[model samples]
Target: MNKRKIIDRTLLTDLAKDVGLNASHLEALGESCQWEIGVDGDMLERLVEIQHQFERLAVMGDDEYRGFYIEVPRPAPEEWGDAEELIASGEYDSREAFLADWLAFNPMETRWFHVASNRYGDSRSIRVTDRKHTHFIITNHSKCTDAEPDDTWCRENLTRLFDYLQRMIDVIVANPDGFNDYVAHNLPYQQRTGRIAQKEFNRIVPNCKIEVEDKETAIKALEDSVHGRSVPPLETMTIRQYCSYYRIANEAYEAYYRKRGASGRFYEDPQDVPEELRDVAYYKRIKFVDEEILYDIDSPEDFIRFATDHYGELGLSRLNIFASNKRQKGWMIIVSNSYSANVGLAIEVATALYKARAPLLIYDAEKLLRILLEEDYVRLVPDSYHNYMGYQEEGSVYELPWEYECSEDTDSVLNKEQYQAIISNAEWQPEEQAKPIA
Candidate 1:
């Protein structure tokens, strides 16, 4: 069997230097030097003694340790709490069960054998003995007093131990052969080339607002913006409400055209229309065709294609509403308090649409929903019947109602099989619900 070489003396020296005086003093203790070769039975026994001495010094103050060290009292194994008593008390079924529960409760307690030392000659040792493949704590010694153990002393010591172990692991994992090969092939130009490449890439692609090329990317950016509190509350209309406004504008424009007997020239530029009527005609021509597209979208794939094709228009319309001194008007507050309320739903719909178009992109509906809820764009709409259901607003509760409470007599009248059949045939219709008061 091949034993992996521990870190070389040079690496240990460098680590000791990095950790400063405390580690330097610990290194001079000679025990850590034995660890450099390999952890052996002699070293382990010596570590156990060192650990006991450290524990004795832990409770001693400067005054107590002025001339000679003072030994601290510790509970013996027989004095320790009994597992069999806990089992007999009915807290646990068996000794094994009691021990399992104890282990679970004290997850942070070290079960592995290890040694730790610091500048003050304070060291800790832990050794576990295996009997019939069942590991039992043989000697668990620490340099801390009972009071000190409850404080940050144990945690800080553990951190130091972890740091030392991590350094050893890092050196063990380092590939000298691989490094030599890389150096032989790449030479001095490799580092310079990498730096130059990265610099040029950054120069070419300077950071600005993320250009939302696809629905998923757009949703991600929006979610990030929301979490960062950078997404200002949308001040304008919901998409559905905006569509209605557009329809009204179109109707008014048509009325104005018909009154003027300009039916033949209706297709002409809105600019050619009377100056007073231009605003009406322009709005009438504004393509609010999203509803038509969304209405027929039966699958996620179809939605994606539609979103990709109309990405610019959808984005522009959203932005234009908030534009300063914009001519668009008559946008009623519908379905939500602000456009922000609809943003989550819009993202969901858009993402579905985009995923339909680009099936290759990884889409996580649950993750996106979570992000929406976190940002307050959407909320978890509670339902007694359904386990998972969400919506944009409490007002949208009209869309999802509680399951109708059936009388006991009704259930008796319809047998289990008959009721199942009726339920299977039942069609849920939102239109039947009473309209929510705005």
Candidate 2:
């Protein structure tokens, strides 16, 4: 890079000599610097496009979003007609005077969108994710841990979607030029591997050395990182892996109660979701207007709130469902509340009774346990992104696994207020109405 010629040569020479910087790294670093400086041909073209976008937006006035991103690493103040000579000559003495001039001259500073223009799709939000933003996070248990679950509900409308996915991945594999640019843009501000494409990024970029304690080890690791070519947290998923992802999202939409609503962000219009899969809202709504539905329970707390409101009582206990030979031994769940509650649970020994359809969530309860209960069971590293204290399974979280055990007296787990309240009442309405078992 031309910048390297003027940078501290002695320091560069020492680092290169010490680490034995290879030719590939040298070239990569040079290209990275060039991108930062706005020299790359594609980047230059993009800059022009961005400027045109700004001009077009400015002409539209306040009817729509008239504001635009002032390009990253904005041009010098002089470029915006702010002459520094005025300040140097004392023409602008106080901070107030300088800011007044800036606000009057800097279009980027003065520009803003109308309040009505703040609606969704009016302006783009910067997001860094590997998968398409659309997702169905929950699913039935079978699809949760299963890598390749059978596709049972391939509705005709979804054909366009699958075809689009196939075409998109084909482009990524054939030439990841756009993908590389996106990763490079967020490389500095994101994790060591950038926001997404993290595993794919590992193949080239060097690991960060900021937190390494041992000086020698840090240098050696950085040197090896750039030079050594290998895989590293999650490699780019193969077609099988991508299919499993599709399976989970797809099944979540179809499994269980087959409720009418969908993700709120895109619910406004099915047409907006280009390659239409299914009319998430319109299809099944009028089907069961009279049925008692678990309308909007998005989380455990929401479930607790609904149960408490409807049943007038809550309790807790254990339920273990055993499996056949060569299978997982059993699955255990914390269940129940105090006996007198009117709420009906489906299983015997459960509280709370519902006559109508209640939707089931497609979820990996095992993985979800690890995420939600991490404070209780997962050990923390003092200064790390991950909770595990050490590499692999060597940590307190793994060593002392936690499972909820019903109290001998109350048949409930304790600590949190909700859990505490569930067990406070010892009396229950009896198993017939209680619908509970351990």
TM-score of 1: 0.19
lDDT of 1 by residue, 1-438 (tens): 223343333444454334331221222222222223222244445444444433332232332220110011112222234777777888878877766655454332111121323323332333221111111111233222231223243333333433444443343235323322332342211011111121222232232111223545556533443343222322443333233333332343344446547544343345675664443344445653444435432333343344334322322223112111122232111111123323334343333333322111212333443433332121212221221224232211111111222223543433344333333333322111111112
- Predicted candidate 2 versus true structure: per-residue lDDT over 127-214, tens digit per residue: 1111211112111111224321133221111222223223322332333344233333322211121121212222222221011123
Poorest stretch of ten by lDDT in candidate 1: 66-75
- Every candidate's CA RMSD: 27.1, 27.7
Highest TM-score scorer:
1
lDDT of 1: 0.31
lDDT of 2: 0.24
TM-score of each: 0.19, 0.18
